[model samples]
Target: MAGLERQLTLRFLAEPADVNFGGKVHGGAVMKWIDLAGYACAAGWSGKYCITAYAGGIRFVKPIHVGNIVEVTAKVIYTGRTSMHLGVDVKAGDPKDQDRHLTTHCVLVMVAVDDEGQPTEVPDWKPELPADIELRESAIRLMEMRKKIGAEMQAHVDLQPSLQVP
Candidate 1:
């Protein structure tokens, strides 16, 4: 089903605090924006408090200079019992330059929570008419990838040696 789209955009002015000595926006700052946007989208979609559980395939495609306007678009791609997958795309460019747009895409997994701050199932989802086929396909692929990654993480944890102090 074609899911919901929610976006948050901000013009990040690179102050010295946000930039490195090399004069580019810090990756950590960009990552913070990404996570915030992702969570905002998730909360809006689920109409409940949501926490980020996973971020997949995050790549910084280009660098942002001091005056670049970063636009972040977040959307609900899929939903499970208590989890929702969000796709966030970050673009860096001058706001005046409408022609320049480069996509920095990342997928985030978020879980809805109840008023007691416990995990809760998402509300019923019914796709609107005239859904986008390509978007649905992409969301499906992402969901599969997320499941595979979760399994791998569990296996890795299982393999870790336990330390027992004598």
Candidate 2:
């Protein structure tokens, strides 16, 4: 997948506005960037509006400093009936050094929607390269883990009154 079309990369400079009181880029800002990149990848592949269904495995490896060059990459690793699983990576480094390192990583699930906001089927993506195949397998494992977590949470939802819907 050297020339894969189901991927999007967004590069920009980390500014003061993105920094938190601790002088590092806010985690919320990085998450927003991840969602934007994932949304672009999902919509580009499906040619339809996509909404983020789930975001998991988000790990902040390093702090992003202001004035660093930030790069966020999102790639579609697997596709289901109406959902696309994307791997999002955020990297940043000083502009002078130009050596970027991974600062954050996550997997996002996006669902394609029709004009009426109904979930719609997306075009199937077949992994052709070895790396792509491995990514697809990873996505499958993540999906299973997510399912288990969801089930466990659901089992305890009734025990927490604050979690119940009004």
Best by lDDT: 2
- What's the C-alpha lDDT at position 111 in model 1? 92
List the global CA lDDT of all models: 0.74, 0.93
Residues 56-101, model 2: lDDT tens digits: 9999999999999999999999999999999999999998987999
The 10 consecutive residues of candidate 1 with the worst lDDT sum are 1-10
On TM-score, the leading prediction is 2
Which digits, one per residue and each the tens of the lDDT, describe model 1 over residues 51-161? 988888888888777677777777766677888777778887775676446547788888989989899987545445455345556778877877898899999999999
Q: Residue 118's C-alpha lDDT in candidate 1?
A: 94
The positional error of residue 62 in candidate 2, measured at the CA in angstroms, is 0.5
- Residue 142 in model 1: shift from native, Å? 2.4
Candidate 1 segments exceeding 4 Å error: 1-5, 8-11, 124-131, 164-166
